[model samples]
Target chain A: MPTHRIDLSIAGLRLALETEAPPADLGVDERYGAFLADGDGEPDIRVVCRFGEPVAPEGKPDYTAEDIWSMYAGADGSWTAVITYPSPDDAPRPPALLSIDAKWRNAVLTEKRSPGLWQSVITAGAAELLIRTRLVLHDSLVMHGAALQVGDAAVILTGHSGAGKSTQAMLWQEAVGARPLCDDRAAIRADAGRRLVYGTPWAGTAGIAVNACAPLAAIIVLEQHTENELTPLTAAEALPMLLARSFLPYWDAALVGAAMGAALNILQGVPVYRLRCLPEAAAAEMVCARLGLR
Target chain B: MIRKDGFVVRDVGGSAVIVPTGARVLDLNGLVVLNDTGRLVWDALSAERSEDELVQCLTDRYDVSPDQARADVDELLQQFADLGIIQYAGQPI
Candidate 1:
């Protein structure tokens, strides 16, 4: 198997990937093209890809199974590994660990590529973990929401499943000529004096992800309401909402603390709002008006 | 008696945060914050301690009366039990 080493620099962190006998395709999304490093710099973390049969707690693969993914909590100051044990005769996944240090977490994107092993899972897992690790190490974080850049500022809209994040993102695109960075997930970073929101390739159902970024202007937590209203949030009020919207590594206390601080800083620096309104262009206008974007 | 299973205490943003581990992993929504007294109670109960023991510890550490300590300890233990951060031995839920 021919090997290839690719260096990906995202969110100010460098990740070096070494693939052993590459698959038909490594399955890495090119939406990260803008963040590709020259490959000459040192990587913060080195990921070596290996192939093997999924081994359960016992020895061989098992047919009797329960959940698709099972997680075991890590001990003190560690990250929780995504562990899945196949029943008797089904091989269990090699135990993996997710930890506090931004670069220590490893996630497998297991997709059944061949007969026994999950090639896609390993590959895809590497892609996401790489990006996620880079974000964590940089005092930045990712959010489950829609991010848009209108003028000099980036606005992120987030909410629960039915909270109309995508609807609001499209409205921003339609009404304000704002570019939709990513409709599903957005990466936020707070550095020195500025906070930034970046677009990742992982788009939601609407498929509106891009390789773009802007200085963060505001964050709006959405709610479906009959009338339009935007409420500014204080640091204390915004903390939990930001935490809920983040991809938290709860197993690691250090990461959790760092993440909490990052969220608090973002809240203090970036204006956070709770917007309750219908899913319409007017909702977008209302938000823009509040932010003085219009 | 209540024991600290895999939970950890950290000072985060001027607040005491208890991070659970192992099978005790808490969902993001279950994130718990402790007041200064809550932190003291948590520290005293790091090992297995009965309600009376905790009440005494609280009273000795603070200037609270035994009656007030008992009330606070009872409430705190109930909450911890509900959250599964601690367990009472040989007691029905």
Candidate 2:
């Protein structure tokens, strides 16, 4: 049979997978039923999950594959599912892979196993997702939960979950006719001696994804209150809040420190404010006034 | 031996710095640096647990002997006192 290959590009990482055996250095752990390997002695941790024939009894739950899906975790501490499709030459069956709840750091991998090779393909896809979204705390591209825009300049709204991030984006569109750069996740990168925030495909509850890039003007942390108001957050207050909300693994001390430093860099270069307000168009007015925007 | 709210805490460079929060950065002598295990112990210490109760809790959570736990607790308390991270609320243990 000919080999089938798939190449997936996600985030900023490139992943290539082929229908061939994996390298020998990979350690196989039967307990987790996966293969683990050290990718170039870096922090790139790789785990390969493979599946075989269903061994469950009739009317009983398929314990073999389903048990693995229960263990997968994403780079941002979010849970993700793995999808697999069976080979064409084999018996007509759907992809035989287990969905595990697991998380990975910086890693790139491709694997091929026996019988149910589709399982390896599924694992490869998951690895691509991990590499793309896993924020390299030291990198110039900083990820934050905010909507960014490019008009006179770039504007960002930083807020916690349920702190009206989506609502604020809507207001920008409705009132000022601003195009959203990103509704939930904004990737801030320095380009041409200017810091710019670009929108990614990842959308929060707002379901808004904008691929626009804009020079960052101001960063506003959203605060819910009874009235519309804007206040300046000192470096001390803002640093911890930003670090806590940052989407990175807290266990990695070096990464956490690097992320803090990057956040401080952003705070120092840009004007950051605590925008407290009710969910209304007036909140946009308050923000515009603070930014000196017309 | 770190007291809750007794130690001023701040997140310094991403790591948690349990100092007197308002204390100046130059006053390094007044702060107790906590390792991973020490941070775990600090998190577990509360007014709700008596000294004996704390020792028991430590023994349950960590793989340490009772005598070792007692010694560690005593040493940590002493360190906290020296750094002013905690103070004796009432009589000494």
Candidate 3:
């Protein structure tokens, strides 16, 4: 029942992980694992990882060590962690730490070796880090691309990197006294059967960030065309397209299906439009007209 | 009138939802309910049967006269037209 703890805060949300004693039958002398639980102490997620002597990919044991981290999401939204050690001789080092700020999110993995060697460890641990981050961000505000406030409502502008997502957000803010939620990454949550999209600290090219949430009014897919036009997309057409642009990586099929189902529920209720136009205020006007805001 | 061709209906979420091969989800409540007669009418409509043809088919299959079958088919067709489930193609069957 020995345990270890790790706490994280992102976009005004706090999450913690509790590690318990590793199982006996896993065949490792050093057995330790952790369960990621919310503040209520109910085990929502679990991570059980063990490390053994560092064995090089080449059939030889190199006291130079490595670690592998695996994660699974429980039915109740908790995560079970499994960390494998290279060998029994390799002592367990401190768990990796990650911090998200206004500029960027950083992950620090500590081992017995120098900082240069941590890169591989960090790469190996990326899956776990991504899962934990996603779990933390779940049920909060999330925008399709980035979100910006227009008048009283928050507008989410989603498109490819060069599709003018940031540019449109800037134009709306400058023309209508609007503010940015986040230019790069938008936080999302579900409330009262509606998905509320919010702005995050991660801003892409616009470098605009403000913490805010709004009931998603519409989702516009951007396309740079000569003529300014807004066309509506049916739920069938929007479902697959939105799934492709979804932020979460496809690690588990069931999780992906659930996420897609949630998205379909949103699309069925919210309006989805295809905005084909040049980057200018005119495009915003077209979008507004489609949303019946104008 | 309910133009039987160029349209299809399927049950979705316990409702008879119409989906044209290249169109959006359209409701066919007036033309078809969940009852046996409504389903039979919908099945006949799928084959592009004319009103007279549908009446004859239904009269032969069910214990109904030609006149009653014709009246039911005509009423259902008008209801389908009002609900946008089908349109008048402006041609003779």
Chain A TM-scores for all candidates read: 0.78, 0.59, 0.60
All candidates: DockQ: 0.24, 0.05, 0.02
lDDT tens digits, residue span A1-294, model 2 = 214333333233333333334432121121112223323332333333333443221232211122232113335543333334344345334333323223343232323345432234343234423443244532444456665553567687877777887788788778766677666667665455566676655566665555456778877888789998898876666665654455533323333345555666766666668888898988887677668765
Q: Estimate how well candidate 1 is docked, as a DockQ score.
A: 0.24
Q: Candidate 3: lDDT over CA atoms?
A: 0.50
Against the reference, the lDDT scores of all candidates come to 0.66, 0.52, 0.50
Interface RMSD, all candidates in order, equals: 6.4, 13.9, 17.6
Over 4 Å off in model 1, which ranges?
A20-24, A29-38, A52-119, B8-19, B26-29, B33-40, B47-73, B89-93
Model 1 TM-score relative to the real fold: 0.76
Instruction: Please write out the lDDT profile of model 1 over residues A61-146, one tens digit for every residue.
Output: 21111333333333333233343434223554454322223345433322223445333443334455456645665778888888
Model 1 score (lDDT): 0.66
Candidates' TM-scores?
0.76, 0.51, 0.49
Top DockQ model: 1
Candidate with more favorable, higher TM-score: 1 or 2: 1
